[model samples]
Target: MIITFITAPILGRLLHPSDFGLIATSAPIIGFVTMIQNLGLTQAIIQRRTITKGQTNTLFWLSLLLSLTFATGLFVLAPSLARYFQEPRLIAVIWVGAALTVVSVIGEQPMALLTRNLRFRLLAVIDIIGIIVGAALGVAIAWYTRSYWALLVPLACTRFLNLIVAAFAARWFPGRPVWDEAARQMIGFGAGLSMFNILNFLARSADNLMIAKAHGSVALGFYDRAYRLMLLPLTQATWPLSRIMTPILSRLQGDPEEYRITYISSVSLLMLAVQPGLLCAVIYSDATVALLLGSKWAEAAPMFACLGFAGLHQTFTSTTGWLFISQGRMRDLSIVGLVSSTSTIASFAVGLPWGPLGVAVSYVISDYALRLPFIWYMTGRAGYVGVGDIYRTVGPHACGLLMSASALVLIKASLHAPSLIELGGILAVTYAINSAILIMFRSKRRLILQVLKVACRSVMLHRTSRKGRF
Candidate 1:
């Protein structure tokens, strides 16, 4: 993650916005195809309470077959998609992405097995190593080659390396295929989840697709960067929690009260982890874009801020997956996904004429207006958790978000400080105010302090272990 944060600006400055835009434009096809390819069967592997070796093997073979089929479709469709986007160069990009998908699905079962067995340390190492190496490789290639292939090649290599590493780390192998009633059940679960993911992929990629088509690649480049900037909290914090939470939540499913309590508590900690960052991004959107992607992306500033506002809503709503998947409520999740996707696509259409900033603003409005309420209501209906529980979990962070936003605004307007100094002052005030408010919340305060202590002890133990080894 640190490597990615550091390298994004360097790549942004080195590569054209068109380059990123091209990637963004071509991404939806891959996203949609991959969702189909997986059939969400892999997640079913993790979600199910018990699975026979035969069921696992059957799913594995099914996954491999679908992956091959989709890779071929992508490779064949590359030219037409490129023509549609009016970026002929996208042909190669799509082709490379096709190969990458084949490599990616190869790891699905092993990785899923690792998740099922709770081998998170190995998963963490696999993820960190794959991304760091991939980012470094992408930066180096882009520096020298100045080509979009730089991005594509590194991505392929990353997945390739991840497959190799995960295979070894997981130490699990699939045997002969066995299709049975259990396989049918697993596929049914996976197909439902796949439906949800298909909607999710459309929601995620529709904005980028429309921006690229209507406004062209340059506009897409800015919007894409802005959107990614907004999603940093989701990627860095909330998404990871969803992974850890789903499996843990699945375990707690039999105990409704415990599951409810745990879900609420986890969401609280997730907000604690991500809310301040979202606040900072919303407050410092321009500075952040300037600092991270360089001044060349100044067009993305307004869009970034708008998207940052959406991030607050996203921080809470993205966690709905935990409740849905853990509770085996994929049908409900799929319905929510349909509504969310429809709302997002409509926002893109409404916002298209005004450009990326308009799209960004519309996204925030749609999220809060449509997606948030839908998710809150749907998850409540699906699980033991309810709307009041969500309010109790998220309300404090929502207040803290408002407080942080106000502090930053006051610092900018009243103090009239310079950019760097003003940002520092805003951050300090936001931190102080939010910290005070959190300390007043005894439960949240305890969780924060507990996490800090665990981190400190882990560091101390590492140091002592090193000394003893010496």
Candidate 2:
């Protein structure tokens, strides 16, 4: 996540916001194809209590076949995707990007095997390295070629690499698959996860598509960049918790108590990290854009504010939704997503009125409205969490964020920063200071202090060692 945040801004600057937007246009296509490849098998494996070599082989072969089929189909439909996106040139990029789906399908289930066993560190490394590689490829290619294709040039490479690395790391060569009723049973569960993912993608990407359709690519570019930059800090921080906890939840699948406790604790941790991020981003919107994306991207600032709050809903809801998967209750998730999709469509409909900004506001309101209730209702089955715990984890953060936003408003009320760079620097500093104070006063203050102390000592030790007993 750290590498992603650092690399992404630099990469965004090196590339054009339109580069991001162009890719955004293809998001639905890529997302749809990726969803097809998953077909619920990966989730099924994670939820499965026991799996032998024979079962794993069956899942692998089925997944590989799906990957090949989906990739070919995507490439074939590239022109249709280009037509849908209204970008003629996107056909080639779509075709190339489709290959990633092929690679991912081939690699995904093997990765799921690792998740099934709780081998997360390896998973983290794979995720971080793949992102870093892809982002670096984006930067380098965008710098040299200066075309939209640069966005995907690294993607295909990274997917291929991730597939190879994950397979080798797992050391589980897939043999011929045996047809088993058990395998088919897993698919029923996987189908539910697949439904949630497919619709969820539509829900999440609604903003970008709405912007592009209502406005234009250029306008979409600005909004997309703002959304990405604004949500970066919170997403980076909380994403790991989900990535780690989901499989951990899967391991504790039968045990509702553990699942609920883990979910609530993780949500609390998310609040601790994310609360201040929302406040600070709203306060320093322009500064963030200028510092991270250069002055050319100042238009993305307000939209960033919209996404900053929207991110809170996404982060928490995604975590809470894991219970459905862990508890093997995919149907409930599918229904929740169906209801939430209405909110998404409604948000886009509202976008028609406000343009990009309006769309963003509608998105936040609808997202929170659905997620607030959905998270509680889904997790209610497990005793460790309930509707009130959601309020508990969320309310303080709201208070703290409100206080920080108030302070920030007072601080910057008299000053209108003329330059993007200045605004960015101000935000960078204010957010830093505010974030530190916020965390320092959170429930984890003592633990943070201890970690900071340990880090300081380690840095000192390393420096002393380097200076030869200085």
Candidate 3:
């Protein structure tokens, strides 16, 4: 995340909007294909409590075979995809992406093993190294080529590095596949998850697809960048939490009350971490765009604000998957996916002709007015989590965000900051004040302090151990 944040702006300046759009156009297709390629077996491996060497070996071979097939298919279909997106360069861009799928296959089983064993620190190190290396490569490529391929080659290289790192870190070797009843059961579970992933991807990408088709590449470029900016911080934060929580929750599955408590606490902490930042984005979209991507991207500011609002609900609701997968509720999760995908698609269609901002605004409206409420009701029905519980968990953060927004509005109305830096400072002060108010609440205060203590101790221990080793 740090690497990307530091380098993305430089890449943005080097590359054109069309360059971003061209790559963005291919993402939905690649995402949909990768879902099929993995067939959700990775999640299956992580969710399962016990597995034999033979069972894992079988899944590993299955993953490799599927990945090879998908890579070939994607490569063959590159021309058609390029034609559809109407960008000839996409043929090369997509071929590179296909190579990434192949690279990912090498790490699939290793990643699952590492996750199952809860070696997250090692996983984090592997990922950080991959991302850092990839970011550097991407910036260099953009500097030299100034082409859409610059966006793709880095991803492929990153996957390749990640595969090598994860294999070494996992310390696991694959044996020959044994196709038996155990493999069948795991594949059956994964098939259900695969379907859910497909629907989920469609739900997430429908807007991108629609924007690309209706608004054209340049328009899509603006929307895509806005969407990327909105999602990056939220995803960087929540995705890691999801990785940690899924296994932990799966381990606690037998204890229903503990599961509920864990979910509520985990999600509450997520909201506390993300909502204020999103609100800050919402209140200061123009400055964010100016500072992050330059004034050339001011056109995306409104869309970014809308997506920022949607990201809040998305951040809260994304944890639903952790709960569902942890509990082996794939069928239930699939149903939720169906409803979510359908509603989101319909919303995208309704907003299509109006352009990118319209699509973004509609998405936010649909999330609040339809999708989130329905999801809360559905996920809560199992008695482990109640809709009231979700409301209670997120309510304080929502209140804090509202207060922060209100304060920001008053500040903007009363004073002109004269520059983006001063404006940022003013917003920072507003957030600090709001944070202090929230900390006045004893429970939030305790949670914040506990988190700080844990973080500090971890850093200190890491330093002490390094010194001892040296």
Candidate 4:
């Protein structure tokens, strides 16, 4: 998140909106191809209770073959995609994305092995290194070339580096392809997940495609940045939790009571951590855009604010996947994806006539009105956790969100066109208000304290371990 905030401003200054748009235009297709490259086997690797060496080797070889095939296909289709988008520059970008697809799969099984074993600390270190190096290189390239290669090259480099580090860390390698019942079953499971992923990607990326086609690259760039900004909190809060919890929850699948308690509490804690900040961003979207991406990006503020409403719920909504994947309910997950993708696409179409802001507004409406409820219903339908459980967990935080928004509104009204410093102060005040409100609730206060205690203990343990190592 810090890297994002730092690099966004630098990149925004060095590159044009069209530069971002061109890349964003290719993102949906690139992302979709990347999903095909995975074929969901990684999730299967993580979710399966037991796996044989033969099965892992088979999956690895299959993944490699698929990655190569798709990469070649993408490389071949680059010019066609550029023609479709009517932007010849996109051809090279798509080719780079195709190469990234191949590099990404080289360490897939190793990374999945790390995830399954709950080696998140090492994973975090690897990610930090990859991101820092990638960000620095991207900035340097952007400064020198002012081209979209900065974006594409750094991403490819990061994936390459991460895979190399992951392979070394895991110390596991595939032998040769083997076909057996275990491999077949895992493939079946992965098929469902892959379907869900395809639909989900389509839903997520449709907006970018439509905006780019309808309004052109410049408009798409603004919308893309706003969408990314809205996702910042979710990426920081929900992503790590999902990664940590998925394997843990998968282990707890047999113990429904524990799974229910664990998932609900973690989600509650996540909402408590992220909700207030999202509210502040919604209230001060302009300031956030100015601070993070420069004043030149002021055009994206309304879009960002509109998307922030959806993001408030999106943080929790994204975690629903953990429930699906961990519980091995891939079919139900696919059904949910089908519904979500259909509605999300419809929403995009409904709003495209009004441009990007309209799309943002429509997405929020569809999310709250259709997608969120459906996903909650489906996830709770047969699980230890139910819809009522979700409502109860998020209810108080939702109330707190309203209160925080109200407080920020009052604060904003009293201030006149506050500067960046004032915006920082407002954020502080918002968090303080949220903390006070949360403390007023006994249950939430207890959870907060419990989390703090665990955090402190982990820190102390880390320090002690470091001293012993030295």
Candidate 5:
């Protein structure tokens, strides 16, 4: 996340909006194909309690074959995709995306092995290295080439490096493919997850596709950047948590009460971590755009603010996948995905005629009016956690966000054309208000204290261990 913050502004300055727009146009198509490339076998590997050598080998070969097929298909379809988007630049981008797709799957099983074993620290190290190097390369490419290749090439490099590193770390290799019973079961499990993933991608990417088609690349660029910014909380915070929790929750699946308690606490903690920052984004959108992406991106501020509001709900909604995958409830997840994709695509259509800003605004409205309620209902309907549990967990934090947003709005209103310093101060005030509100709730206070205690104890233990070693 820090790396992202540091690089985005530099890239914003170095690259044109159309460069980003070109990449954005190809991203949905690449992302959708990438989803199919995995066939959800990684999640299946993570979710399953037991796996044999033969099963792993079988899945590995199957994954390789699927990836090659899709990569070739994407390479072949590049011109068609470019024609569809009416952007000739996209052909090269799609070809690069194809290579990236192949590179990414080369070590899927290794990465999934690490994940299944709960080696998150190792995974984090690999990912951080990949992202940092990628960002650096991207900046250099942007400085030189000053084109969309900067964005595309770095990602492929990162994936290639990640695979190499992960393969070395995992110390596992695939043998001859075998279609054993266990492999078949894993495939069956993955099939359901793949369906859900495809649908979910459509729901998420429909807006980008529609925006690019109707409003053009420059408009799509602004919307895409704002959308990516809005998604930072999910990408940085919730995603990592989901990775860690999926295995833990899968282990705890037999204990209903424990699963419910664990999930609720996780959700509460996530809301506490992200909601205040999102609120700050909403209240200070223009300043944030100036600070992060420069004044040239002033056009994205309203869109950013609108999407920032939507992100609050999305933070929690993103976690629904954790519950579904952990519980082996992919069918239920698929149903929810289908519903969400339909509504979200329809919402995009309704907003398209009005341009990207209208699409952004409509997204916020639809998330609150349609998507959020349905997601919460479906996710909680049959799990150890229910609808009421979901509400109670997020409700207080939502209230706190609302209050903080109100206070920040009033505070901003009182200040006339606040500088970057004032924006910083406003963010500080927002955090203070949220912290105070959070402490007012007994459960939240307890959770906070418990977390602090754990953190302190870990620090002390580390120091003591270092002293002993010395």
Candidate 6:
């Protein structure tokens, strides 16, 4: 995951943002289909108290049945659906993607075992290996062919590899499917999560479709790149947090109060550090885009600036959805989906006329303005996480970000940056200075000091460990 995160800049430098945009356009349709394949069985396994081998086999067979059904439907509809998007070549692409159905059938039980055991280190390693291989393939193919298909197929192929490896890695072998009673208990949970995933795709994909329809694929490409960049910070925080905190949250599950406290603390720490990193990226949007992507994606710089504010909004609310899931308050999650999708669809309806730029603006408003309030309510009422809890965690970071933003703008404007290298340095320095001032003035002097102490300790420990024998 870390390597993939770091490799993005290299990718941005190599491929056209439009290439990414084109592939992103496929995601909604593909994900919509994938949602159907799961039928909630996988998630049901995770959230269940116990999943027997026989029941797991039943779920696996059911998943395989769904996969073949969906694949057949996909193959038959592929050309028409491609034409619907006005990219008829997509039919062949979708045909190839349909193979995942067969490949993933063997994966459900082993994957469930891994999840049941909470062995995410193996999971992460598998993820990283797949990405490393896929990214290498993507870069090589893009550099050689410069075709959008290169990006599209590599994504599907990597998942196929992961399913194959992870299936065997967990040492679970497949057997005949048998109907089981335990499987029935999991149906509702799976259905709800599947529905949520579908709508979530629509909410996100609506923006891409609108942008593509109004602004064209070239512009949507730039918009997609910006959105991807915006998400890097979330990925950074969530990837690790999901691994570490979920177990902790699971242990504290019997006590809502403790779970709530730990949840809020985890979110707070994630937001506090990620805010400045994203702020720097936003401030240096032009430089960063230019440095990584060169002149070809100059349009993406403004797009990055446009979508960057979404990062701040996400910092507070991203994990709230998980909170709703953890406590079985999925009604809140459904509400979140309903409201966010409605807001985004409505915003896209109103904003598409203005093209990609308008889409970016509406995204920020719909996400922060409409969706956040509901998330706040959900987390507060269901998770028992208080309003003050959020205020305490996010308030200082918000202030620091605001300060950093102001300094960044001034520094960028003042320097008349001629290169990405210069702009990155200026943004980093200004953000640090601004953050320092904010930290000193904020009443959370104790928290600030604690972070400093940890930083110093980490450095000393690293040095000491290096100097001593392994």
Best by TM-score: 5
Tell me the lDDT of candidate 6. 0.72
Please, what are the lDDT tens digits per residue for candidate 6 over residues 68-95?
A: 8888988998888777667766677677
Q: lDDT score of model 1?
A: 0.82
Instruction: Give a tens-digit lDDT track for model 2, residues 187-301.
Output: 7888888888887778777777777766878888888777767667666776666566767877775676776666766676676566555666566677766766777887888
Q: Candidate 5 lDDT, tens digit per residue, 312-334?
A: 88888889899999998888998
Instruction: After superposing candidate 2 on the true structure, give the runs of residues whose Cα lies further than 4 Å from its correct spot.
Output: 253-258, 381-384, 418-470
lDDT of 5 at 324: 92
Tell me each candidate's TM-score.
0.95, 0.86, 0.94, 0.96, 0.97, 0.88
Per-residue lDDT of 183-240 in model 3, one digit per residue for the tens? 8888988999999889989988888777877778899999999999999878898888
Whole-model lDDT, model 2: 0.73
Candidate 1, TM-score vs. the true structure?
Answer: 0.95
Worst 10 residues of 6 by lDDT: 438-447
Candidate with more favorable, higher TM-score: 1 or 5 = 5
Instruction: Tell me the whole-model lDDT of each prediction, alpha carbons only.
Output: 0.82, 0.73, 0.83, 0.88, 0.87, 0.72
Q: Write the per-residue lDDT of candidate 1 for residues 1-470, one digit (tens) a residue.
A: 57767988998899999999988887888767766888998889999888877788888888889989999988888888888889998998788777777778888888888888887888887877778777878888999999876666556766787789878887767798888887898899999999989888888888888888888999999998888888876788875667688888889877999988788778877777677766876767778788889989988988888888778777778888888888889789889989988998899889889998888887788788878887888888646898888877777777777777777787666654247666666666776777777777777788789878999999999999999999
Tell me the lDDT of model 1 at 46.
92
Q: Report the C-alpha lDDT of model 4 over 63-117, residue by residue, as the tens digit.
A: 8999999989999999988988899998888888888888888888899999999
Residue 195 C-alpha lDDT in model 6: 70
Q: Cα RMSD (Å) between model 3 and the true structure?
A: 2.2
Stretches > 4 Å off in candidate 3: 415-420, 440-442, 452-470
Sort by lDDT, best first. 4, 5, 3, 1, 2, 6
Candidate 2 lDDT trough over 10 residues, lowest sum: 438-447
Evaluated at residue 446, the lDDT of candidate 2 is 52
